[model samples]
Target: MSPIYFSLVTILLSIITITHATTITVVNNCDYTVWAAADPGGGRQLNKGNTWNLNPAPGTKMARIWGRTGCNFDGNGNGNCQTGGCGKLVCNPGNWGTIPKTLFEYTLAQPNNPTDTIDISLIEGFNIPISFSPTSNSGALGGNCRTIRCTADINGQCPQNWRVPGGCKSPCTSQGIGTCGANGDSRFYKQRCPDAYSYPNDDPTSTFSCPSGTNYRLTFCP
Candidate 1:
């Protein structure tokens, strides 16, 4: 091939590679509507049995997705939510979802590597049941490439002092616990969801990684 032809081919391949994106599907199985919120992708209302598909920018490595309940928004994306409110239809990329909400955390493809980190985190507390799983089975890189969830009805069993209307606050936030070790609240959450991050430092068994190209699905109230 001529030099110019080779250069053009390389450019085209680069464009194609840059355009490729990882798919993330969010599904709602709750009886009521849930405002699905993400840092980079913003927010959207998902009624029961609805699904929202997102393709975040490749540069967006770390992101969080959660559900907000009891929201009232206008056509212009102006509104408030009872939980995880960002005051708009599409949450600002700079804004974070409220605490006492379950979070699906992800670290997308890194430089020169095809591995992606994923986990269901209860460190912010629990508002609803959630599960994170790889949609495709091809990226099973051993150890952490498995489905994880916090399906327990934690709100119903929340301790009186940590109980909130729609969620349960972690004792670390409510009772000023030092860490999530050997504490009643930590024990409560860990016992229910062993695969989730019950505290900030919980990583040995909580974090998991998979091949970057693998698609992901997050289900709410599952």
Candidate 2:
């Protein structure tokens, strides 16, 4: 083989090798936001199929996924999906409001500033937010989370929007304690009432801290 031909073939092989060596890892669940890894290959929209292109370059994961929940709960962005008054609560308009959908969020814990969302090729598993229904039937003003019930004891009279309407339901109840006490301790508190609103869990002296051995591992922006 001629020296020139040999050189050309070697260069082409190097390029192919480099293109096929990309790899990335994505850790996603149904909690906060929908996260997708930007594959370097730039394939077609594959998230709908749970498939990603070839791995992106190291520190090349960049992209903003829309919040999964509260997509179109309300017709318009008016938070009122109704004509008379029989409208389900729409996505709360304004800055960083609650979403009606349930999802998970994955964040990269690397100590590097990614130029874009695609610059990070890995997800921080420790950063997962298990979004819970904040004040079920009723919506709390703010600084409050949804209430989950284990039984239909209160006839769905928890709060304005907390009542489950039909019957009682239990979701993600076996997490820890319904309400954690201050000093990072645990007490025999009621788990979520069937029809209850925002119960006082953390206040001046009721900071809901994780159990003694548990850590504050949340992925969403606190």
Candidate 3:
């Protein structure tokens, strides 16, 4: 071929390679499973056979659904899940009925593998039981936390100064509040406690109760 023709061919090949490279992405399309639990001061009154919102991170692909079962929360104490066992969120056919426990599935877009993250929200239903155990402390309070009401928004639910007393954190104990281990952040721990305790126990403190017929939503970490 002529020298001029060879030069043009090489330039065209180079451009094509660059364009293809630009389109390639590092983060592969993946599927993930997100478990849902009750919100802090809420989610305790729900029946052991209630349905939870398995929220997913935005821009992410939901592949499968799996979790434990039951609700566990203390109706008394510092509003923590101290008990190790009471209720759990698991993959069970009975709770899902015929619909299959799968919350939803989606396809993800190409990612740059950057240190960025996505956020997602989900709405869950509940049967808010009646008369949640109240705290021994004296304080006039009123609110039908019982009653199976629908769900409300949970934006800003997780605050910056929220901490879960002691060194316990997620996977609360039977009492609903779990130990955050040795080196734990008491601030972020409490703010994130509501969602954490909602999984195992339906009650935390006697003062903080879930009336039957109320539903709640919460933001959880992925």
TM-score of each: 0.89, 0.22, 0.20
Residue 65 displacement (Å), model 3: 11
TM-score of 2: 0.22
- The parts of candidate 3 lying over 4 Å away from their true place are 1-90, 93-141, 144-188, 191-207, 215-222
Tens-place lDDT digits, model 1, residues 1-222: 999999999999888665456788999999999999998888888999999998876645669899998889888999988777888989998787677888888888778756787888777788989988888764377647888899998999998988887899886676453555546668899999999988777888898988756778899977
Pick the winner on lDDT between candidates 1 and 2. 1
Pick the winner on TM-score between candidates 2 and 3: 2
What ranking emerges by TM-score with the best candidate at the front?
A: 1, 2, 3
lDDT of all the models against the reference? 0.83, 0.25, 0.24
RMSD of each: 2.6, 16.0, 21.3
Residue-level lDDT tens digits of model 3 in 1-222 = 999999999999887544322110011111222223221111222233333443333233323222212223344411222211223333222232111111111222235432111111111111111111111211212542221111222223323232222112222322233432212332232233322113312323211332111222221111
Q: Model 1 reaches what TM-score against the true structure?
A: 0.89
- What's model 3's lDDT at 106? 21
- The alpha-carbon deviation from the true structure for residue 94 of candidate 1, after best TM-score superposition, in angstroms, is 2.2
For model 1, state the Cα shift of residue 205 in Å.
0.8
